[model samples]
Every structure is written in structure tokens, then in C-alpha cells.
Target: MIRTTGLTKRYGRVTAVDGVDLHVPPGVRFGLLGPNGSGKTTLVRMLLGLVHPTAGSVELLGAAMPRHAASVLPRVGALVENPASWAHLSGRANLRLLDAAGSGGRRRDRRRRVEEALERVGLGGVDRRPVRAYSLGMRQRLGIAAALLRSPELLLLDEPTNGLDPRGIGEMRELLTALNAAGTTVVLSSHLLTEVEALCTRVGVMDAGRLVLTEDLAALRTPTGLVVLRTRDPARAVDVLGRAVVARSGDTVTVRADDPAALNAHLVSSGVAVAELAAQRRSLEQVVLELTGPGADRVDPGRADRAGPPHQGDAVPVRGGVR
Candidate 1:
């Protein structure tokens, strides 16, 4: 439903969005992936006609942007940056105002749309509460309700779960999943890779100002049939596993295996001591770095720094072998 070619946008000498072409078919939950300052928001803005691109062309719902923004935008919903609502107004009140200003239809129709949106986002019961009294998650749902006020064919959300806790994030994911299952195409832009993995069917990776890669999540997640194993005796385990061994160093061995679980079991059955075993599947994060080359992770070092340390999800505990 959206296509762009050679889409370029610049702010003086610095190009915020390079010549990137994006194709989003109907009914796909698309994720735009990037680190901070990777031109994600800029691309979305250019598509929405909120920002004028310095070069290239865009077609939204088969109409050229800005030129046909009025007709096309009514079918596109967006929550760019962060969505805001009048603090003093009730959630329903905020949506009512948005529906009137944004969709422009009969007052009765708009009112019905407001109720449907509130119910759709699970804020139906709390719609009477003022927005300022809503939790961060509730406010986010309200923002999405405002977006859905137009019954948009396509929904654009930038970091929809940005500041929410784990529970809130889970709720947002479920809501987005339901929306997509109900046939609204969603384009979600996020710096968090895990969220993209959880929510998107197709993904586009951005680096600097360019689109480095785009692929279906399944295709991109193809297993390499590689496994990394830490063993009490690497040499003996390698000898026992025979041709499955790929490389060995210290007490660790990398093995070629389509099934790490079976391989681990076999090794233990043969009495090879496995300390830890982990599949070496290439993650989207790792593939992104490979595409962007070295130092890609340093784009905004301070961002990662401020976020503190990374998690230890990669390591698997296999004290006695494949536990």
C-alpha cells in the first residue's frame, strides 16, 4: 500500500534519510529497524508529508505524497514522535476532538468511531478518566485510538511501546497483533530488535541514513546449523563428535548441527562432557552489524551507554551438559 523510490531527505549538509526505497504490501506487519539517528522517524515523516524530502518520490495508497496528502492521509494513521492529548480532557474527549479534526465526518459517525476505537484499544471502561490520570500504557492506547479514529488502511507507529514496562509492552504487542489480524497493515519503527522480532512479519534494517536490508522475518532467521559448545574437554568431545566438529579453541568447540538438542544428547550419550551448549544462529542484530560493517554499533555510543549494560541472553547454562 506504500512505495517509495530514491527517497532522499536532507537537513542542510547532513542527510537524515538517504536514497531508500521501501515497499510495504497490504496486510504485512512491517518493522523498520535501526539504532538511534538511523533515519527511521525521518523516513516516516517524509512518507506522511510532515517533512518535505529533498529528492525522490513517494506514493502512499497509490497517490503521490504532499500532492495528494489530503486524500491519501485520511487512509493513513500515524503516531510519530510521541502522541499527545489534552491533559485535562477525558480519553474519550481527546479521541472525539481528534476524530473531528482528523477524519471530518458527521458528528454522530465520529462519536461512534470514538467509542469503537476506545473499545478496540481496551480503554473503553477508562474512557471517562482524564488523560493525565491514565497510566503510560493507557495513554499509549489512547494515542493509538486517536490514530485509528480515521479507520486507516495503514497504521504507522514509531516506538509504540517506548517507555512502557514489560506488561505494558506485552499489551501493546497483543493489541498490534489483533489489529494486523483484523487486516490493518502496520509499520512499526523501533530501535529495540526484540520488539521487532516479536511484532513484525517483514523487517527493514536502516543504518546511518540508508536501508541496508529488507527481508521476511522467517527468511532472515534461517538457522545456520551452527552450534557453539563449551566442554570440560573440548578435544575429547571433538574426537567423539567426529565430522560434526567445525572449529575448536580452549575449552570451546563450534559444531555443525541442524539439531543442537539431538547433538547435545548424542554427545552426552557418548560420554563427552558438555559444559554449555548454545545454537549459533545469526541474530537480526548480528546480521545488521554484518551489513553495516564494523563500528555500526557506535553510531550513538552514548545511547547504549546511558541504557547501561546489555543482557546475557546469549549464554546457556549446561553445567553437566545440555541442561
Candidate 2:
């Protein structure tokens, strides 16, 4: 439901998003992953037409961005970076004002929509206390509730779970999963590996302002032609398998076998009582590290000195707006 061709943004000579070609299909939780200064937020802003691209194009919901933003954006809800609200106003008051400012819908249903949004974000029982009194997690949830005020078909969230605790994070995951299941396309932008692994169906890794890798989570985690099994007789299992056994530790044996079921059968037939067995697969961390270089957030002055004078684009400043 989102497509970009050669999408790029430049701050003078420094590029924030460089010639990115991204495709996100409908009915999936797509994760956009990167480090602190890897341009994930910049890319999300460009997609929402909040930041103009220096070169290339963006398409959302089958329509060109900015050009047709007024028509398309109403059907899209977004929460970029942090959610902002008047600290002095109650959460419900803030949402009421926001909903009133937007076009479309009958005025009579405003209260109903606001209540539904609050309830969806787990703020249904919240009192009318000023937002300044709300905790960080409460504020985060309020922002998510604001985005859901419209019940848009598409959700573009950036660092959605910033200040949430473990329980709050889990609740957000469940909420996002439920939304996706109900046919709303979700595009989540974050640097948290665990969050993406738990919530996303597809993933795109970004580094140095480039879209380095994109793949389905299942495909990326495919078995690595190795089977790990725990048995009471590790030595006996190793002796039975011979060269096929790659490593052994105490009661565990790792075998280089393509078929796990066949390997298990052989081990059991040979008097090897297997306790636990599973195929080895590459973790998302391994795949990301393999495809991308060090995070752009880290800068080594010694390396820079050895490399001589830095290029203009080499030191891309990550200000609040750019991030």
C-alpha cells in the first residue's frame, strides 16, 4: 500500500535518505529498522509528506504524495517521533480539540470517536486530569490514541513504544497485532530489534540512509541445515552419527542434517533418547549485522584522522528534525 522510487532527501550536500526504493504490501506489519541516525524517521516523514524530498517520488495508498496528500492523508493516521499535546489540558480535551480541527465526519460523533480511541489505547478509565500529570507511558498511549481517532486504513508509526515499560510494550504489541488482523496496514519504524521480531511480519533494514535489506520474517529466519537435539547419551549419538555431528556439549548435540525429522528418527532408533530437538535458524540480529555496517550514530575520530579530511557528506548532523 506504500511505494517509493529513488526517494531521497538532502540537507545541502549531506543525504538523509538516499535513493530508497521501498514497497510495502497490504495486510502486513512492516518494520523499518535502523540505528539512531540511520534516517528511518526522515524516511517516514518523507512518506507522510511532512518532509519534501530533494529527488525521487513517493506514493501512498496508490496516489502520489503531497500532490494528492489532502485526499490520501485523511485515510492515513500517523504518529511521527513523539506525540505532542497541551500539557495543561486533559487527555480527552486534547483529543477533542484535535478531532475538531480535522475535516470530515459528523460533529455529533466526535465524542463517540474520541471515547473509542481512548478505550482502544487502554485509557478508557482515565480521569480528566491534565496531561502534565500523566506518566511517560500514559503520554505515549495518548499519542497512539490520537492517531486512532480517525481509524485510518493505514498506520505509519515511528518509535511507537519509546517510554513504555515491559507491560506497556506488550500491550502495544497486542494492539498493533489486532489492528493488522482487522485489515489495517501498519508500517512501524524503530531501532528496537526485539520489538520488530515480536510484532512484524516483514522487515526492512536501513543503514547509512540506504535500504540495505528487506525480507519476510519467516524467510529470513529459515533453517540453517542444522539440527540441535538434547539427549541422555550425547557421546553415543555422536558416535552413531559420526561426521554428521558438528558439535557436542554435555547432553546436547548439534548435527549438520537437512531433515530434522529423519535425524530424530535415526537418533531414536539408535537408542538415543532425544529430549528436545529443533532446527537452527539465523537470528534477525545476525542478518542485520551481516548486511549493514556500524551504526551511523558512532563516529571514531582516530579513524577519521587516518582517512584524512572528512567529506562534506561524511558528517551528517542528526538534529531533531532529521532524526
Q: Pick the candidate with the highest lDDT.
A: 2
RMSD of each: 10.7, 4.5
lDDT of 2 by residue, 1-323 (tens): 99999998777656778899999999999999977667787888888877778799999999998699878877888888877788899999888888877644786799899999999989999998999999988988998888888878899998899999998899999999999999999999998998999999999999878899989999999999999999988989999999998999999899999999999899889898999999999988888878776665578775321111112332333111111
Q: Candidate 1's error at 79, in angstroms? A: 0.5
Q: Against the hidden true structure, what lDDT does model 1 obtain?
A: 0.79
Whole-model lDDT, candidate 2? 0.84
Clashing pairs in 1: none
TM-score of each: 0.79, 0.91
Provide the lowest-lDDT 10-residue window in model 1.
Answer: 314-323
Name model 2 segments beyond 4 Å from true.
Answer: 104-107, 303-323
How far in Å is the alpha carbon of 207 misplaced in model 2?
0.8
Pairs that collide, model 2: none
Cα deviation in Å at residue 173, candidate 2?
1.3
Residue-by-residue lDDT tens digits, candidate 1, 1-323: 88999998766556667899999999999999877677887788778877777899999988998799778877878887666778888988887777777767799998899899888777778836677888877877778778887777899888888668888788889988988998899999888888889889999988778999989998888778899999888888988989988999899999999898998898999898888998886788777767653323454445432111111212112110000
Return the TM-score for candidate 1, rounded to 2 decimals: 0.79
Candidate 1: residue 132 Cα off by (Å): 3.7
Task: Report, for every candidate in turn, its global Cα lDDT versus the true structure.
Answer: 0.79, 0.84
